[model samples]
Target: MKNLLESPPDKLLTALRDILAAKSIVSPAEIAERIALTDAASPAQGARMVARAWTDPDYRALMLHDGAKAAEAAGIPMRGMPPLGVLADTPDLHHLVVCTLCSCYPRAVLGYPPFWFKSAAYRARAVRDPRGLLAEWGTVLPSHMKLTVVDSTADYRWMVLPLRPAGTEGFTEAQLAALVREGDMIGVTLPIASA
Candidate 1:
């Protein structure tokens, strides 16, 4: 028998997948479906939603009320995924998301969470010192604006709908989407208007 340890990582994974498929433990189609689902929840899709919200008040309302539904309406496949919550940053309020127990990010909208987002220090500081944490990330909110830190859970995840930056009045949805970054949706940073 060949030593499994001697096989390349990719080769070993492929071999295991083939064995599993042969044993009826899982199928190629199932794996492909899961991969497709995961790919659907990227930052680009989140940006598209944000751009739509900026252009349409109704969509903004729908997104804030029911994120999962809004995502579905925007053609993002979210079957069997947990409910999503969209938080909007108003002039007087800001929202931040973190999973206290673990990294329960809105993968469908933000893809994978950054390494720092999954760190123990970030989880604790995000709740205990949101202002400081935001400052560290170069996101300093107005003194009068309140900061709200929301915890993401297994059943409900959150995505931030950042306030549209000034000087974007004439920009198209695609252009606006270009300005939206993963950090902006995470509330760690705000989108800047391009000159």
Candidate 2:
């Protein structure tokens, strides 16, 4: 038959899909929609949430409690994606995120992973020596402060909520958001106030 002569990978994929559906694991339609959503997600969506949290204490608490619900409330598409875990950086503690197994980042919130994020070196270094890595990135924490490295996995993704910079008490939400960078959300860098 024509199907028999088709590529083995396609046949394998079809078989896998059928097995998954038969086992009631995940439907093929859901998978397709997830792929579409991933493609549609952008870093700007995450920046908006950060800006809102910076300005709204209630929203910040909600975000820290249930990141998925907060992100949905912010109008970011997360219909079929895994729940996002937001790690907030404080004066005495800092959070860093990395995917040791692979580049399992919060793509729906922070867009595509950077080149270094997917590199083997970064994956190993993040868990091994987070302070050193942060230092290399020009983020030197206080000697008494603590650094926490969080690992992201396939089923769950993580993002960082950087501390709002000082002397910007009057900055509007849009202006605050403009200062947020993709790296800041990923915990690789901090957001600096623009003059």
Candidate 3:
């Protein structure tokens, strides 16, 4: 109370919420729940899908057709939303996702979004010209296949879900899953198994 009336702005705001919570105006659990929730599931989920796609053609088809159901079929619950869609990034094609107004993502498939996705530079230009944005990420796609860029507003969020490289054709699901990196899942890069 000593600092609330006459202190500078930063000091007034500092520790302000904690004070309010102590007074029972807002429970600590309430704030924790708000901050702890993520826009999507963790990136590990995407890696699993990609690995399954490489090994099982039927499972792959299911994922591409109905991603949400496919995820639950694989044991990851689709937190709240429905109609999950999986955008596959092929050898010649690339996919990137954005939400112009807000970050709408596939929490069950992709997981929490990276910090860069929320930045002003990414949000502004990703929709206007996605190819340029991919270039900034060092992602180059053949000009022939359309770069399918989806939007994840409140209604949807996306997972990049990278394609498996050629060398690992005989790899088991474990090995295959290892190659799908976070950047690959977000459409920034493709996973190339190291020699």
Model 1: lDDT of residue 189: 91
All predictions: root-mean-square deviation over Cα?
2.5, 4.1, 4.9
Q: Where in model 1 is the C-alpha error above 4 Å?
A: 1-25
Q: Kindly report which residue pairs in candidate 3 clash with one another.
A: 40-107, 40-111, 41-107, 41-111, 42-111, 104-152, 104-156, 104-157, 105-157, 106-157
Error in Å for residue 130 of model 2: 1.3
User: Model 2, 133-163: lDDT tens per residue?
Assistant: 9889998888998888998866888999999
Residue-level lDDT tens digits of model 1 in 1-195:
877798899989898999999999999999998988886668999999999999999999999999999999999988877899999999999999999999999888779898999999999999999999999998889899999999886689899999999999899999999999998998999999971
Clashing pairs in 1: 41-108
In candidate 2, position 16 carries an lDDT of: 86
Of the pair 1 and 2, which is ahead by lDDT? 1
- Could you tell me which 10 consecutive residues in candidate 2 have the lowest summed lDDT? 1-10
Best of the candidates, TM-score: 1
Q: Which ten residues in a row have the lowest lDDT in candidate 1?
A: 33-42
lDDT of each: 0.91, 0.89, 0.74
- Indicate the residue-level lDDT of 126 in model 2: 95
Q: What is the alpha-carbon lDDT for the whole of candidate 3? A: 0.74
**Cα error, candidate 3, residue 64 (Å):** 1.1
Candidate 2 off by > 4 Å: 1-36
